[model samples]
Target: MSNTVFCKKFQKDMEALDRAPLPGAKGQEILQTVSKQAWQEWQLLQTMMINEKQLNLMLPESRKYVMEQMEKFLNNEPTDKVTGYVSPDDIVEL
Candidate 1:
């Protein structure tokens, strides 16, 4: 697919997420490999954005919003204690 089509699909996904009115936890699946395999995942993402030239397409506010959400999801501690056949409170939505 074209880059424009891909970006449009991504934008639609973000819009859908924004419309949802629930709190969410970070995506362990997305971060597990990408973050552990590379120490500077965030920095590398920025570098990749620069290389792809998509950074220019993103608004400053949008970039900042992404960073804020990403950091909160990745760095914050989970609040619930789950047992077998049960899930943590923080992961309830998922």
Candidate 2:
């Protein structure tokens, strides 16, 4: 049977991740509270933020910024705004 969690992000029960998504205590906490779906969504957003902002994960400040975003994301708080971005699908076919 698949595991389930009361997702903090969605505020509902959902399928749980098979294991911690990251290391350390924060990862363990996420494993217990975050849903698989929410984690996947965060992964995509994180990638976009890294790419659009040209963040160097090797830098401590960049890593810290991403970590802060992660916490806000999981808590359903307002996250960093993606400036001047429009979804490709949102562009009307010319």
Candidate 3:
């Protein structure tokens, strides 16, 4: 496979991940379609969601919710927003 892939999220050719971020078919699908940049952005969003929502990964519901959110995010569809979270770009330096 080439070092680049047509990223589904970004809708353009971008750098691909060195390997699947996870195991199983989902991981392979992401490896083929999701760009490195998109995956990194997803990770940040996932972390914030977990922290802000206090999602317990041990719970099946929590895991499922995250997976659903991941799919929506990768597809550039609407997903649940993290409340009270601020983007670094939005923060102005005094």
- Candidate number achieving the greatest lDDT relative to the actual structure: 3
Model 2 lDDT per residue over 1-94, tens place: 8999999999999999999999999899999999999999999899889998999999999999999999999999999977766888889986
Of 1 and 3, the candidate ranking higher by lDDT: 3
lDDT of 2 at 28: 96
Worst 10 residues of 2 by lDDT: 81-90
* Each model's lDDT: 0.35, 0.94, 0.96
Once model 3 is optimally superposed onto the true structure by TM-score, how far is the C-alpha of residue 42 displaced, in angstroms? 0.1
Candidate 3 overall lDDT versus native: 0.96
Q: Following a full C-alpha superposition, what root-mean-square deviation does model 1 have from the true structure?
A: 16.9
Candidate 3 off by > 4 Å: 92-94
TM-score of each: 0.24, 0.89, 0.92
Candidate 2 structure, TM-score to reference: 0.89
Error of 2 at 69 (Å): 0.5
- Model 1, 1-94: lDDT tens digits are 2111111212221111112122344343332222332223344444554445434526887567445544543344231221332324546562
Candidate 2 ranges with C-alpha deviation above 4 Å:
88-94
Q: Ranking by lDDT, best first? A: 3, 2, 1
